[model samples]
Target: MAHKLRLTRKHQVALTETAHRNLKRFCDESGLSPDHALTFLFENASSVFHEETLPHRLRAFKAALAAQET
Candidate 1:
């Protein structure tokens, strides 16, 4: 049987109005709750960092730029 994963940690972040609006827009477009979206991003980052061929640092920078464009 597969167990559902749960995140119990809490974090507080400060965002500018524009950043918050962008995050909200991304959440709306992807149909994900803010918590889930953050979880997904962290999971994706983990995978990216584990890759061998591409430098993890470069990939992370690219991902950040892509996220900003959304």
Candidate 2:
């Protein structure tokens, strides 16, 4: 049986311009509203982390943001 998803929590996030653009593109291509896409991603995030280079990519992403803040 497929598990039903419920959006039971909310948090605000600041997205980089590139991230925002990519998210918009993904939403358009997938025909999912941003809310549904985000909810689905959150529910399935473990799969996302399975990409071998994701940890490296995450560090680079964080470093870039830190550089912007400095």
Candidate 3:
């Protein structure tokens, strides 16, 4: 028999409208519920981290910092 893990805690996060829209679109297209999409992403977190999928704002901040040195 396969064991199923129960997620007993709820985690809430705030996102910009654009981010939320994109996430919703992705979930809709992939046929995954929001919770399941999050679970799937969590399970493959290492790959996402390795790919450096930082949000656009954060990437822009990094670029700004680098430009200051030039």
lDDT preference between candidates 1 and 2, better one = 2
Query: Hey, what RMSD does candidate 2 come out at?
Result: 2.1
| lDDT score of residue 53 within candidate 2 | 85
The collision pairs in model 1 are none
Using all chains and alpha carbons, the TM-scores for the candidates as numbered come to 0.55, 0.73, 0.59
lDDT of 3 by residue, 1-70 (tens): 9979667668997887987897799799989887777777788877765455467767898898799989
- Whole-model lDDT per candidate: 0.81, 0.84, 0.79
Task: Tell me the TM-score of model 1.
Answer: 0.55
Q: Roughly what TM-score does model 3 have, to 2 decimal places?
A: 0.59
Q: 1-70 in candidate 1: lDDT tens per residue? A: 9978698887897887997897799799999988877787777976734577558767897999899999
- Which ranking of candidates, highest lDDT first? 2, 1, 3
Pairs of residues clashing in candidate 3: none
